[model samples]
Target: MKKSLLTLGAILSLAVISCKKSESGNKSVIKTDSTATIVTDTDGKIDSVSQSSSTVDVNGKKYEKTDFVYKATDGTLVKVVFKNDPKESTVAITSNKKTFTLPKAETKGDETIYKKDDMTARVKGDSLHLEQGDNIIELKRTKI
Candidate 1:
């Protein structure tokens, strides 16, 4: 009986530990998402825009930008700029290296979705989700 009790106690302890680990993992994910808030300076200007760690290869070289603008693998120019207001932020994606501005993004819940024609750009939780027809791209935030 004592051996059975010991075995049961060990199982319960293992279960409790596993539960705690899973809960901590979930909390960490939540924290990582929430920490990507818009950074602003004392003068009310956007200090730096949040960006993902996604990289695109142009030609045979991989390129990643830390700024608000960059060029994708297919030579599409992409820009993400802050507008002080979360709802007013903009995401512009143009091909052929042409310069064009897109309308401000529309906020839905915690995400900003930018839709133009068949393209969709969703910015949320330190990640960028880009979808064009059947092609989907996901970019995670760059760690400091």
Candidate 2:
């Protein structure tokens, strides 16, 4: 009886450990699709406009970005100068040398800044991030 009880206890412990390992092996999946729009006035009227999403996996790497309008403290859309990729480049796992900054405005306003080196903001996984600079705002897909 003592031997049998010991064997049962060992088996139970193994099962518990296996379950934990499997759970950790699994990855969390997040899906998003949404829209962000911002309109700013020149002068000291509006100083900033900005928006971004949470960490998401794109083309296998983790990535996230502010929404259409990332406002600065000065009430300016400094980060959102460029709405979309004019080059119409494809969104893939590979990195592109292209970089963009907020469009220069005549008014005294803030600019939108993109942190490209942030690893948590990188795109990952079999999933792909499309252009339009539109991050997953809502859980929907664009007509590709």
Candidate 3:
């Protein structure tokens, strides 16, 4: 029985080693597509942004005027009109259908100042600081 089993195992090993997978003459490797396509939908909407500026003649020199918008405390809208010639600018506060304009900044520095008798306002970057007799408030900057 042992001799028969050894002979059967040897024959099976020889059969596996001698068998070469039948190769057809037309056998070739075909590559699969590994790329994908992407689609984007905008719902037929597009936005356009334009540069806004106005030209002003100052002492025979042209100066461009631009307005930067910001939001103040108490939900008030503050629009600051800036000129390219000088560092002078004005802050306009509109609330409840009433608009008040602050005087042009007198001091020159990083912060723009609007000063009057007792009220002083400063605008630096997106910060709005206001001071009166005994009241002081700061506003946050907003983009439009």
TM-score of 1: 0.39
Q: What does the lDDT come to for candidate 1? A: 0.58
Better of 1 and 2 by TM-score: 1
Better of 2 and 3 by TM-score: 3
Give the alpha carbon lDDT tens digit for every residue of 17-76 in model 3.
Answer: 998876553458675676532222244433121214467786887776655555667777
Error of 2 at 142 (Å): 33
In model 3, the clashing pairs are none
Q: Give the lowest summed-lDDT range of ten residues in model 1.
A: 81-90
Give each model a TM-score.
0.39, 0.20, 0.47
How big is the positional error of residue 7 in model 1, measured in Å on the Cα after superposition? 95
**lDDT tens per residue, model 2, 1-144:** 999999999999999888744554436766466665443445535324333334556566655443332222333222221232332212212213443432312222242222323211212211112234444321111111
Which parts of model 3 are misplaced by more than 4 Å? 1-52, 83-89
Q: Each prediction's Cα RMSD?
A: 15.6, 17.1, 21.1
Worst 10 residues of 2 by lDDT: 119-128
Question: Top TM-score: which candidate number?
Answer: 3
Per-residue lDDT of 139 in model 1: 57
